[model samples]
Target: MAQMTIAEALREALREEMIRDERVFCIGEDIGIRGGWGGAFTVTLGLEKVARERVIDTPISENGLFGVALGAAIMGLRPVADVQYGDFLFNAMDQVANHIAKIRYMSGGKIKVPLVMRAPVGATGRGAQHAQNLEATFLTIPGIKIVCPATAYDAKGLLKAAIRDDSPVLMFEHKLLYGSKGARSESGAVDASSDIPDEDYVVSIGKGIVRREGADVTIVGTLLMMHLALQAADRLAQEGISAEVIDPRSLVPFDWELLEESVRKTSRLVVVAEGPKTGGIGSEIAATVSERMMDYLTAPIQRVASPDIPVPFSPVMENFYRPDVDRICGAARKTIGD
Candidate 1:
């Protein structure tokens, strides 16, 4: 076992998957260039040496690049299309929402879009154009699967699984949670690193893992916000507030059973997310919890999320824009007051 960051772990997964399957290849901008930033981060660095032809580099055309992946997927090739930024996903909306997601269903389940779109998300002082969390954008989509891995272990495991999955999958990686290093390192990075296994592993999509177990309240979060929830949980523990922290690694195929069971145990729920409050991921979780576990709730469900506004450019305002430990802890306290 070795300690690894999310970026290193994902690179390893891609390398392993490409070696295991000749059909697997990466298609994106700056992925294979020597001394270049690997697809906006270093996740694809040094991949060219492993599979020269498979490590493809493309022009700065998100729509065109994504379309090629869809075409390849239709022909039974697994292509990992990398978008430079999550916000740039808007450029390829038609390809993703219209084509890649609906190919299998439109073909009456005869086709499989075994394609993966990797995008780096979350605000890292890059202003609005590059910082948006796009998970909420695809929650309602029928065909595409969404996975957001917060830790190094899940990042590697989930990426491996996504490569093998037969449907279109969107992988949203958080900038701060990447634990990136060198020139591509983030200034205010969070250490979500973990000791990855020596053997091959795959974290099945649609399953949620409980990071911390408690009985007073259940706190749900994903990606960067998942780390925030764990921080809040620690503080809440200091105050004698037992809060359970859950990481819904796969957002679309949400682990409703895990959430429902945790909510039932705690009888209180507070969801934390980095995106805006309106139509945020918390909205769906809160709604589902109310629908399925309302009987177990002792108080109204609370949500700790950003305001319905653009992420601020200033670091202080950015911190204020997103949910923090104090906010989450307060929400938890409000949900289950002493």
Candidate 2:
């Protein structure tokens, strides 16, 4: 076993995937640059030296690059497309939410899009344009699968699974939880490193993991919110609140069974996310739990998320805007009416 940062683990996964599949290539801006930040976070640094042809750099056209990836995917090639920031996904909405996501259904299940889309999300003082957590926007999209891994172990495993899968997959990496180092390291970064297994393994795309087992309340979170939820669980434990922390790595095709199991035991649920409150992933989770596990829930479901406003540039407001340990704990208490 080896302790690896999120960036390192992801780079390792990309390297392995390319080696495992001759047709697996990467398309993104600055990823294969001579000395760039390696797709904005060093996740692809030094990759070009080994996989030069596979790690193809592109212009700053998200729509164009993603269109090319979709074309290659349809041609029986696995393309891992990278977006510098999660917010930029909007620029490629036509290619992503429209064409690529609809081709299989449009073709009556005769085609498969073995494409992996990677985007780094979370607030880091980049203001509204680059710091948005846009995962919620694609949750309702039918074809693409979403995976937001919080730990290095999950990053590697889920990424491998995404590459091998026969359908389109979206992987959202948290900027603050990447554990990136050197010039690409993030301020206020959390320790999300994990001891990755030496042998190959894959975390199933639709499964959720219980990071902390408890019985008082269940906290469901993704990306950096997952880390914060676990921290909140630790703090709430001191107050005699046993919070069960769950990392729903895969969003679409969500593991409702695992979450229902936790809600059944805890009899309380608090969904946390960094996205906006309204019509967001949290809203869907709360509604889903209310519909599926209403009888199991002893209290009204609560959601902790940012307001429906653009992300702030100021450090103070940005910190207040994103869901933190305090915010999650408060939501847990509110759900239980403590």
Candidate 3:
């Protein structure tokens, strides 16, 4: 096992995937440039040296990037497309939402799109344009799988799995949880490193992991919010709250079985998401749990998320804009009547 950050583990995953499969390649703006910030967060830094021919750089066009990847995937190439920011995905919605997402389904399952889309999300002083948590937007879109990795272990494993899967996978990485080092380090970065195994492995997509087991309430979160939910669980334990924390790493094919089991055991639920409260990921989870497990729930499902506004540029407002441990703890307490 090797201790590695999320960025290092992801870089290793890309390297291994490219080596394992001849058709696997990476395409993005500034990704193949020598000494660049590895597609913004250093995940692809130094990868051009490993497979220079496959590390294809493109113009600053999200539409063109997705178009190229969509065509490549249809032609039996596994393309890992990178977006410098999660918000840039809006620029390529036609290709992503229309072509890449529906080509296989529209073709009656005769075609496959083995494409992996990677983007870094969360507010980090990049303002509304560069820092949107896009999980909700893509989750609503059908025919695409979404995976959000909070730890280095899951980061490596999920990317490997997404590359191997024959479906278009949207992988969202939290900017603050990347654990980038040196010049690429992010401010207020969380310690998301893990002892990754050297052997080949993959975390199954559409599965959720229980971060902390409890009996009073189930707290569900993803990406950066998952880490904060764990911290809130620690604080809730001190007050005898017994908040169970769950990280639904894969959003599209959500692990409803694991979530149902937790909600049944806990009898209460609190969903924490980084995006706005209205029509957010948390809202979907809350609504689904209420619909399916209403008989087992002892209290109403609670959702803690940002307000219905664009991400603020100010660091102070950004901090207030995202969900924190205090907000998670408060939501958990409210769910369990603490």
Local accuracy by lDDT, each model: 0.92, 0.92, 0.92
What TM-score do all the candidates reach, one by one?
Answer: 0.99, 0.98, 0.99
Once all C-alphas are superposed, what RMSD does model 3 give against the true structure?
0.8
C-alpha lDDT (0 to 100) for residue 327 of candidate 2: 84
CA lDDT of 238 in candidate 1? 93
Q: For residues 1-338, could you state the per-residue lDDT of candidate 2 as single tens digits?
A: 99999999999999888888888998998998886888899899888866789999998999999999999999999999999998889999999989889999999999999999999999998899989898888987899999999999999999999999999999999999888898788888999999999999999999999999998999999988988898899999999899999988999779998999998899999999897999988899999888887788888898899989999999999988998899889989987887
Model 1 bad stretches (over 4 Å): none
CA displacement after TM-score superposition, residue 44 of candidate 3 (Å): 0.8
Q: Which candidate leads the pack in lDDT?
A: 3
Off by over 4 Å in 2: none
What are the per-residue Cα lDDT tens digits for candidate 1 across 1-338? 99999999999999999999999999999988987877688999898878899988988999999999999999999999998889999999999999999978988989988999999999889888989987898997889999999999999999999999999999999999887788899988999999999999999999999999999999999998899899999999999999999999999799999998898899999998888899989899899889887788999999988899988899999888878888998999998765
